[model samples]
Target: MSVEIVTARWIVTGAQDETTPVIHDDAALASRDGIVLAVGPAAEIKAAYPEATVTDYPHHLIMPGLVNSHHHIGLTPLQLGAPDYALELWFAARLSMRKLDPYLDTLYSAFEMISSGITTVQHIQGWATGDLDEVLGAARGVLGAYEAVGMRASYCYAVREQNRFVYEADEDFCARLPAEAGRVMAAHLARQKMSFADFMTLYDELKAGNRNPRARIQLAPANLHWMTDDGLLAIKEKSDAEGVPMHMHLLETAYQKEYARRRTGTTAVKHLEKLGLLGPQLTLGHGVWMTEEDIEICAGTGTCICHNCSSNFRLRSGVLPLMELQRRGMVVGMGIDEAGINDDRDMLQEMRMALTVHRGPGMDHSAVPTPTQVLRMASEHGALTTAFGAEIGRLDPGRRFDAVVLDYSSATWPYQDPDIAPLDALIHRAKTKDVHAVLVDGEVIYRDGQFTRINRESILAQIAEALAKPRDTSEQETHWLRAQVFGEVERFYDGYVPADTPRIPFQQGSSRV
Candidate 1:
């Protein structure tokens, strides 16, 4: 039977035309076979579909489900303590920690994301183990968690050869590595520097197993920094051959810029462009240290950038010239890099941080990103970044019926002027607690503070136990090594400064990314 949901005073579809026109008194939506059939006046739609199952959501605002352009569900349990050092040091500290149980971690993160109204996530896998069976086992566990929670995701087994150098340490450190870690890392290395054959095999396996054709899942080469010239090229070739998109961390920090210049005799973006790897299929993450030439290449190639505002600020990564990128016709999407950095996968908080931060002082305060723009970055543009733009993002007839319903009566007071615009309220004032319902492909996965399809309590308990099981960190030379790896990263910032730059870090006092 068809499902009919009605009684939304306003609907924000995330369409190109900003404003989502209000329906008379009550609006309604109808869906069948997990695809939207119609959205209009309740009376009209109700009369048209007499036999449809009806759900009333009086006075609520309905909108498209959020699309998180970049997320790492497998990293949620690692949201341990704050990293008060530089990028390299923080990465080292993260590497030292014991890996969490993949099933528990994935389920915990998915539940949190769903509760906050994220219907889709482009998940970049970051864990490492030695054997192929173990690595695939961990990945399969994550995929199972996503399926169990009824969430849509684009899963990418992140690959890199450059950063592996950092992980390759003395025998003592290697000996301390978790049992599962060795197995997973080995499996990944065997397939390292992904070839066309590897890509086809993985693609075939995924395509054949996914019974729900509407579920958007793709294999991606998740490269970070200047991994390898050959590996980068191979990633591009494989993605083109399989007709899937690829993603990577590009120019995330000034350190990467320096590293790229030293290694390839060019800027990071320039290096990728030189390799002929810049295109619409490529989704570059961070892009905080981009140059004007880099911006031009992105616009010309129609490549999208995942703007990770929270992680950038947390690690002292430079601010991304967002307005400049937008002005040049570059597509931008929002991301919470790892759960450990953001502390939570709340998109509303992520959106708020993006709008307020990144605007340097003395720049017109009014020039900051507006609420609507932030919402777009997390929803429509985010979907576009992952090459799933046509499948998800907006709420419209013929599109997948993915949506989130917020309770306006919450303590956060989502109700404002009727003329204030629903999208504005959603972005500027909404909180995670305000999210009362979430749907992916017309399936009600979360509602009334509980998950409809999964056992939230059991997953939470499993993750807590997994995190509590202490691994041997005795190999760690110092406690500060767990906290701040380089002693003092701020010292490096003393003498050197950017041209005409403000003294303050980008995220100084801003709550919004």
Candidate 2:
């Protein structure tokens, strides 16, 4: 077999625990046929395989390409004229956002990811309002972008059998409106209506027709309130039938916590546990408002959590008990939900946020997240949540050779202290601009500010051209209807979280200073 040697100043063979060893001092990784074969000192690797071709990054540090474990939408809601409101209120505001071409939209986010050391994304595709065939075509477009770009994607069509707009049933919420508005809202909901069976069909067709070697079909429950128990059961059946994993969004806000207590008279985790849904096969996304009991249940079931740190902050969703989850031996991954704090999908920035956000307001150092823990979240733990499984997260033998090289000059050239561990320095200082090259399957897909397969400029220009056009009739209609319903949606939630409900994350929904 043909062999390749990738050399760098340092090579961190992705961490799994606080004490996982890291390679240093001119380390090199050798691979054959896209699978890692060996990693060692540069000279030893080269001498052992003198005939192998070398791709050396003398000024860089190499590590596993990160996984963006939870994501949705290419365009940010802020860019679509929606303000950052609470999670529930943000739903109505999102209706005013403009529709986008699925192919170009997917490419936009894919570019952002590959350029910033992220090679895999859990793209939970949803919010389609059309016939089955039309939505299927959009799903194809999303997959097509990832395949063309050579980025690994664990894709799922989010299943929402109810509660498309609010926590209440779609019919119930629409029926409560004034007559004229009610008619309009019902018609709007009609276009999005699809049976649980139809969603399964969508999954079957997508899985059968998928041509992306770097992509796999998965399932998502959308959210606890969005799916009926029957709908969730159907998803479980489909998952078991297909042998695929499920990523679900649950307990993202204090309001959602209240909604769950109202529906099942128990915490969301206990309800799911009773339904036999919690397991290693499932990942809970957001999970910001999970209680200590919920965390314990997840730990017991070996269920995974994808913590969207920035989303929780931006939407005023309460923070998940991350410190507690770690202590419970739970597997947690980091995600850039919607967008990062600076309004982009940068996993490096995401890692920093996850590292620092959970540090309590005290002088204690033992419980705070270590650099090793954050790296695990972005790499190995993130892989657990995706269909890729143990295939592509680490730079280890028997795994695919996917890695990113970052120029160490930016973070360490100016006389930084030597005693700090390699990961600690990287976690605190690295930025997107420091990413020098990204390799997937031992093939360099990105290097020196350019993608190997896709043209960033051309794709972006096409997107700009599309959005520049004046609003179409359908688009204009959606904006108008959203304006009329915005106030009603706000009123519907007035005193929604009863005074008796226990608030673990925040005592109140939101209050201005």
Candidate 3:
């Protein structure tokens, strides 16, 4: 590609710390060969890169593309008939969802993310079932979709050895179910059952086959409640040997915290620490129930956490105490764990929600989350959680020129002030519709309501055609019954906690007390 200079009315140099995002006015960004060359005064850039093509936006705000730190299959659980239930029960309801073509399903979400200023995503590929060949093919289809769209992605094959559905052993949980239900559950487990060695071999083969620079594979042991000790050890060994980062769901529910004590005689963080699994290479999906000590361990080990505010609220998983997490100086990132509030995967709305939801009780104005903090989490901090590692989040001189251009006129229309901070207004008020263009590696992949590389409308049409077929009626019946089984399992888990004791996330030590 030829050299080009993108000049905007204002440019947001994303937050490098807790402070406000730095903004440059009347500036231009120069790029060539898919990398940024400079970001400085437009006049200077014009004088230096006079031969470079210039794209001018007089009423636009340019910033680094959002990095979605954690995501599962693109389809929101609610969209597929799974209502708002606890995480475990919701998983059961999700089993009934008809599977779509992996490529289309992946693109379905990719379009939403790209349209909303997200350039990179950490896709936690958890639906690895069927035969080995089928699983490999599915993985390829998903990754291929990202490659097709020119978006960066970190793909992690979720591995779990035991406790596929509920916290108990598979056989024990099945014993409590009806005969027909037991058979269905057993068959499901049988399909999911694969030896750790075989899984590692498969991962090796898949990673070797998939050499896309934009997409990388990593490891994820589902969670402490699901994986056995051996499985955890395997993940650690592989992560260490291969030098690939690992991301996993951890203590997102109160029940999980209780289960940790019963199973390991300590907190989940402590157990992971004992196993030598806490480090910079590990990123926890949701640390909603993390205690003070857990936070300390995370800070000490340089571990990262991705806060999925929308999912936690939808599932009644309790607030993540994000203010506390950031105050502790731990690496934090933002994620629309299950799309967003509207199930449209709007990063702008996600940013607003993340900023508003974590306000603690006191009247201290500074205690509330700042727009800059949320922006950093969505951009720079988020890059840390993915395989990209600081390469795609910021719009630095040497970084990849991945950015989102928002029409400032539409974002702050009807009321625009010169003194008002543009970054603050953009984060608080911008919508996906305000996004004028999205660039990846110096190329405009999405511009003016269209994807430059693919026929998005045709892809949606194909998806509609695939879903027109009626699903299996028997599978629907099992979905309804499994809800009851999962409910019973949840009740059984309550036995681990004592009625006299109040299960709190952490103890607050007051100055007077």
Candidate 4:
């Protein structure tokens, strides 16, 4: 086992308690065979590992790499020309875009992730079609790209056996549309349909086929409204029996909360509890509309919540009650989801946003998410949602050496002051360009300005070339038809659930200014 020692001015070892990320100065971390062996003062680590090769970063901040807790295909919906619609309408707009090659698509996002110091990502792969062979191939390509980029990815093909678009049956949804638009949607649904049994079979095959340590697979039921009772139970049974972790989207929007009320007569959290799906093994994404009662269930069940602040704001999903949820001892993770305030997958900026957006109007500072808390959500807490668990989120001994090195001079050294904490500076001012190096499994996968494992420039060029093609005529036709039926979808929701109901997360389905 080769031993390597990395010495930096500051080392931020994200919380062991899983809530607060703490910083150490003049630190050195030593690793052997890709696992961290020790972390302490530079002199001590050097003295202890005299035979190890040493790499010094005199003015850098070494920290655990950011973990993106929830992602889908790595492309923002906006790239498809879909403006920030509610989650429901966003789904409709997505049909208008053209699909890219899986390998290139996956690589496109991996580059963005690496550039911004994200070492791990949970890719919730949602499908518009369920052809087993095609899905399996795409899954392999996605995993292959991550392997090539040397990023750890927890993957799950998102499963939703019902309610493809709105919270209604296909026949009912189509009936609400004009005849021509109805035919278009029905045809689309027919192409996308798959038996519940087939989904499980595909998952099993995917699990068996792709065995890369960095590419772990898990179960994800798309959402409460999109799943049937039997589908939920089957997923729960498989997850429990196999001891694999599971994640699902829950109450991402007010409409989803209302849909839960209309379907189950209770909160989505409570509904999951009754179905034996609420447990530490399951992580719920979004969860913006969760009520106090739902928070209790999440806390009691030890379930984790992934807070996608950027996606929520863009999609008009309400702000997550971060303070209340954390106070209840619920595990919270930070995710960029699809896009951030800058409409890009930049973790540093996302961290800043997560810290800022929760500062409610109050004299009590405790209501705000501190830099330490936000850092933990981006690091340690985020790892809980992935298959790596506690192995890769910290720089402590016995953990994988997954870390990012920041150019402290760029963010803090211009006016260096001992009074300001390095952690505070990083969470507040660090930018993606300030990321100097990224390491995975004790190896410097990205350094100085290039990736060691793959030809990033060539891959990106190929992606650009592919995207330059004009949209297919058939796809354009589909886009037009889908747009025509979008109003019908809104009408269906308005007719079934009055717009004035208290269950909506905001007033009139719009964000509170």
lDDT of 4 by residue, 1-513 (tens): 878999999888776443355667799999998898988899999999899999999999999988999988755667867777777877777777677877888887888888889999998887645487777787888888898889999988888778887888988888888898888888888777778887888788888987677888889998998789998999999998878899899999888988999899988999999998998899999998888788888999899999999989888888988888878877788888877778788889999988888776657766677888888888888998888889977778899899999998987656868686777877788888789999988778888769999998898788778878987776777789767887776766665656577653321324469
Note the residue pairs that clash in candidate 4. none
Per-residue lDDT of candidate 2, residues 1-513 (tens digit): 799999998898977466454656788899998899999999999999899999888978899989999988887889877889998889889877877888888889888988889999999999888889988998998999899899999999898888888889888898878887788888888898887778988999999998777899999989889889988888888788888999999988878888898999998989999988899999999887787778889999999999999999999987777888888888898899898898899999989998888877656676788888888899889998999999988888899998989888876768668797666788788888888999888989999899999899999898888889988888787788888888899999999988786544522335568
Predicted structure with the largest lDDT when compared to the true one: 2
RMSD per prediction, one decimal?
A: 5.5, 2.3, 2.5, 2.5
Model 4 Cα displacement at 279 (Å)? Answer: 1.0
C-alpha TM-score for every candidate: 0.84, 0.97, 0.95, 0.95
Total backbone clashes of model 2? Answer: 0
Candidate 1 TM-score over all chains jointly: 0.84
| lDDT of every model, 2 decimals | 0.69, 0.87, 0.85, 0.84
Which 10 consecutive residues of model 4 have the lowest summed lDDT?
503-512
lDDT, candidate 3, 212-268, per-residue tens: 888888888889988888789878999999989999899999878888988999999
What C-alpha lDDT does candidate 2 achieve relative to the native structure?
Answer: 0.87
Each candidate: how many clashes? Answer: 19, 0, 0, 0
**lDDT, residue 90, candidate 1:** 68
Candidate 2 lDDT for residue 51: 94
Model 4 spans > 4 angstroms off = 16-20, 495-500, 503-513
Mark the regions of model 3 whose C-alpha exceeds 4 Å error after superposition.
Answer: 473-487, 494-497, 503-513
